[model samples]
Target: MTLPEAPRGRPRDTRAHQAILTATAELVAEAGYAATSIGAVAARAGTGKDTIYRRWSGKAELVYEAVFTETESGPVPDTGSLTGDLTALVEALVQEFSAPAAAAALPGLLADFAANPGLRSRIRGHFLAPARTRLAEVFERAVRRGEADSAVPVDLVLDTLAGAVFFHVGLVGEPAGPRLAGQLAGLVGRGIEAR
Candidate 1:
């Protein structure tokens, strides 16, 4: 027997979208990647499996959007000086890496990255590329202002700063806050600034 189709004229439920994403991130954080499932997301979100499937094809698409939605990079503001720009950049770093989605999903995502080249590629393209482009803009501006040496390796500096925070978060379990931020800014800034 054929099931009756519902009427087509209807608005998309943005609340359901948000609920699904929130539930996905929380689950990733709580259960790790291997354990987070589409069925679980649907249940936790208080929505039907059909609703989730209608929007997202499966787990990867849903989880990726959940982690990347709030973290996409935009222009980092010119804080007037290189140090200020650097500080702002690091603050953005803290915000991105410390976000609930990233925090919960990273452990599993990194593992997946090692084994799944396609997943790694998607992450690099969608998330890392945008953030790197913005950081490069900040450093390029600093160079134009003559605040830092044009010869300064922006990639290394950025990697160092961001990697340090990642290490502290993943290994030491230290909080990424203003104090740690200032210290990082000072260390990297002192090294990068023209002396």
Candidate 2:
């Protein structure tokens, strides 16, 4: 499927949409996720609470989209080899998860997810599904090229990479740098490479 078209001409509605997302992200960054609210986001965005409400059902949905939408929208990498593709994808993930806003927002978001199964399911459907679908395409290409085993588990690979980043950054309190991406790709590549 084609990627969604970019907004044209800086329309007012589009501007407001972007503003709300930006405001939500900034608030979550400045104050913890629990502290951010739709009212505050609306105020920061120079809009009204009704405007935010019209776009999102609640804080969790808004914050999830604010923090994650960009991460899921990029072009899928096809760098010829499995290692190269893995490196590119990992680098993007590292860059995304390592961002100050995302790092600050995710813990709170996950906490909300634990409390709300519907929200979690919706989040998975919207953001995670697209990313996984793209990753599956990458893996399918790798398998076709004999660079990866067909038996390689996609979800496990995703969990490992995402888990490592969260653990390394959130628990260890160390920055996950670009170097980590290449190293991670190398290790994951070893496991999936065809015999």
Candidate 3:
């Protein structure tokens, strides 16, 4: 039997989407989200405001998409061992926190979240939830493999790991590097390892 041909249409330009996101990140870093207008993003991106509005409804939606567009999803390494996986996971998290654009944008994001509960929820759903889901899968796999406590809540584990990294970066103003990752992995590994 012959397979059906694929549908024909103009493919979306991910490059343009990335340019807009990059512009948004830069603008938000220079000016807080409250001040970073869609017009500015359009200007920086070399795209029309209409194009941005076509993709997103308004400033909040655009900001949310821009922040989340920077994040990548699963395919989190298994590495055939819980310790290795956990270590890699921590390293990835630290790397993300240490990125210049991400680092610069975080303070403004926190401020925006504080000002608007509804916007905060939108961000949590779009950005935080996906990352948390990937991390939770790692924890769940460890639990199934008898490497971690089944009783421990996945949300708690995710919060602990992320909270530790963010605290170090945001509070101490230190680069969340391998050292921080190692420290976090050590603490989390001990908690998860079967006793």
The number of the candidate with the highest TM-score is 2
lDDT of 2 at 153: 84
lDDT of each: 0.75, 0.82, 0.72
lDDT of 3: 0.72
- Give, for candidate 2, the lowest lDDT window spanning 10 residues: 1-10
Candidate 3: deviation at residue 93, Å? 1.6
Lowest lDDT 10-residue stretch of candidate 3: 1-10
Query: Model 2, 13-45: lDDT tens per residue?
Result: 778999999999899989979899898999999
The residue pairs that clash in candidate 2, if any, are none
lDDT, candidate 1, 151-171, per-residue tens: 887678867887887888655
For the record, the alpha-carbon RMSD of candidate 2 to the native fold, in angstroms, is 4.3
- By lDDT, the better pick of 1 and 2 is 2
Deviation from native of the Cα of residue 113 in model 3, angstroms: 0.4
For model 1, state the Cα shift of residue 104 in Å. 3.2
